[model samples]
Target chain A: MKHRVAIISVGNTEYTSLRRETRSKAELAFAAIKEALDEVRISIEDIDACVFTSVDGFEGNVRPARVLESFGQAHNVPLIDVNTGGSAGGSGVKEAVHLISAGIYELVLVYGSPTFNEVVDNQQVLNTASPPIFEKPFGLGAAHMGSLYGARYMREYNLTARELAQVAAKNHKAAVSNPFAHIRAGYTTEEVLNSPMVAWPLHLYEICPVSSGAVAMLFASEEKAKELCDTPVWVEAMSSIADTFLSGYKVYKDFENLKILAQRIYKEVGIKKPREELDVVEIFNPFAPFELLAYEALGFCEEGQGVNLMKEGATEIDGDIPCNPSGGVLCTNSGISASVTRHAEVALQLMGKAEGRQVKSPERGLAHSWGGNDGQFHTVAILSR
Target chain B: MASTEFMNKEYNMHLDFSVSLGPAYTKWMKALGEKKILANKCSKCGRHFVPAKPFCEICFEPIDEWIETDGEGIVESFTIGYAKFRNLPDPPYVIGVIRVGPSAVSMVHWIAGFPYDKPEDIPDKIQIGMKVKPVWAEERKGDLLDIRYFEPA
Candidate 1:
């Protein structure tokens, strides 16, 4: 809180399925970094520090940050590597904010690498994330981890399959305008219901695809931000929460940890009404049901009333509190990159540069990211123009 | 220029590990072989942990007391796998979050031994908060798999 930090620019590479991706890891990093630097009209030498975010073994290389040339070696900038599973992207941004806010660095670059680019079977790798001795042998994967929440929430709230599909259908429709999205089928509610069920209460359309892409964001101190860019999205407040490593320890009825975290952060920033005060929002929804759960946890509506908000079209791009205008992680989940894009998308929306997915003259917004085994960690950031 | 062909390289890692199950997990796993479920109770907070925690997270105290449960649990939540993935079990398998006996925290295991006409009928057959009992394996190995799965009681 000593020094102020702001996001000046964001860079993104085109997204595609992991099987069809032609861009090499290094190439993807280069293109995204170049675009970000070019947008700010600066070179790598101008950056004070860089933060690389990705999971360790998912990249096939344990130290993926070292393998890629983030121009840190040539430019003599400190490149700090951060890994917190899927929330690594959000945690990396938090690190950059700390570096600038603590008066250590003026300008920092956070690169969200494609964490699942090298995987042959993503579920095999994701299975390793579970508690090896106890939970790993029960055939539990990422989708199954997500479905535990969907099944319990549906039961407690009497949420029908059609209601859950409508939420997924909303995000799919939003992805139609996102050029960077991997799956832009723009499926309807009926189509979502028709999609193959990967896990109970979660269909193929509700789950995120194994997308391949990269994203970069430029963070600067108050002075550097004012000097380099005209419209800088200011960081209002940001923090993350953690849970037990064992999935069994958590109660799957709701986002209990996220609700506690939102209360603390919202209280810190004096956000009385999250649904009214925030102009736009971006949520970490690798599973479509998460968005609805997050809506309740974020206090956008009363618990179990998320479906009502969706039914009324209140979260649409043109409606009040437009969420996931970038189509969210459901459409393009390049692992950590998708988490970082949640923040990057909110920044762009507040800066009036969201292109086709821009909300109407947004001044303040919120970005959230969830990761680790069965939502072990969650990061929430409040941003404003 | 964008190339039409992209070369891909394949690699594999076959690694094995032997993790030390400390005093708490050792006792819990050893009990499984005898068809018993042991839960360690935290003296400070009075919260019991199934798979027995060495210490209470909230109370921050080492747990030395333990209790033996009847091996019956209530399903808190469950998911039915309808699609097959590599290295995972076949479709129609159910994974349940069951709070065994008096444990404050639940443990995850497979839920089976219910009658169903088709694979798709599995989801409808199970319900949350349903009572389930352990189905012991023929050969006990002091492992989590000692109880093959949980069946409706």
Candidate 2:
């Protein structure tokens, strides 16, 4: 039998417009953690350990884990600082699940804060991710790297810029009901098209603004979850894969990694035909193109047919398989928090806690993460009621 | 941060240093002094690699053969960055993925034709298959910086 784990409670800080708030990183994280504890009616003494995730380079401070001792972690309990660039949030969730699966802790709290958005020239930091001696000289920032894949995809596959805009417009509309979302304002296709180009074929509005926020979730073993909360989001399957350092993997061409992960996740959860079975999905699309790519990659739709899924309204909030009901990274791209928040969104729907942005009967929700230059690292988790 | 207390000091020590080059990079530096771009060739696999590698990841064998690559290439893809990372040249520089010979692999380097003095004047009219050649430094001294960038032939 598989070791069972579940999310008992979820909490988050109101995603603050960067210009509206001026709080330190620790203060922001503390507020989210306190809210999560209060939601579950638990105290700091009851928490077993903490998994803190954030990209330190964005904070201009390396080793943020050491500085987190002030955030109410008990002296003896473990605190693991996790960082995996944009995927750090999902990585924290995977770490929490592993902690319970290994019988190391009965309950663990995972939290990721927003530190990437407040900094100036944020793209410069992303460009430095490659080896300084070799790759950095070429100015390989996220957008530049994304364009390489985007241009190739557009050229070879005949994907248009309008389809990319549709994703941004769709997510923006979804955020209208999410009071906690950073950007809830609706956008028109013309508005996205009229915006300045951050990178060619991608406009300013088409990309997410780095925002200030924090997300926290409580993870418990099956027994503790059953005894504590009325509704617990069970973790049916979770897996993570790292690609080659250079973007020379065969999976990119065949789009095989996501297929393999999705197949295994479905098998583990005893589901057939994900598009027909899974109730909701929150796939990371840091760039607008990746969501459509993921729709195909995750086998939600056939290859070269993701655009049709969007046009057919299958990915709408009330559609067959709602995609990104919480506005996703498009509305709020707070680096580390973006990926982590996807899990929290799924957990909320599973527990019937998502207030305005909740989906109906979301029995099985999929949260996925992609990071590294040219979408190198990936993680997928299947959460069910 | 250390210099904040002393307002009168003319100079302040900044400990912003990095160990950039690894072991295999020394050979590439030597080759650069002769105005040549060199990569290690896998004798067993017939593959050439830049910044020189000791072994081929695919063949799992030590690469004993070395090949001198032609400095002539074309700009396969390029980006004009507005901000600089740590220890790099000031912003608004033209960098490109240079495609050389039969190998599809492209090396990232600065583009010489770009006017670093007045970056705004530098045209964005560069094409994908434009012919270019490496611009070597006047005084070659066994370093990767020997070729500052590549420019149109």
Clashes of each: 0, 0
The alpha-carbon lDDT assigned to residue B77 of candidate 1 equals 94
Per-residue lDDT value at B23 in model 2: 53
Residues A1-385, candidate 2, lDDT per residue (tens digit)? 2478999887788786665656556767788888888877888778788888887666666776677653455556678888777778888899999999888888899987785744556676676676566676566667656555454455446677787788788888888888768888878777877776655545677677768888888999988888888899998888877654553222232345667777777787787888998888998876677777788888888887887999999998898999999888888877788888989998898888888988887898999987765566778999989
lDDT (Cα, tens digit) per residue for candidate 1, span A312-333? 8889999898989888999999
Judged by DockQ cut-offs, is candidate 1 incorrect, acceptable, medium or high? Answer: high
As for model 2, its CA RMSD to the true structure in angstroms is 5.3
Q: Each candidate's lDDT (Cα)?
A: 0.92, 0.74
The C-alpha TM-scores of every prediction are: 0.99, 0.86
* Chain B TM-score for the candidates in order: 0.97, 0.70
In candidate 1, which residue pairs clash?
Answer: none
Residue A53 accuracy (lDDT) in model 2: 84
C-alpha lDDT of residue A13 in model 1: 97
**CAPRI quality of model 2:** incorrect
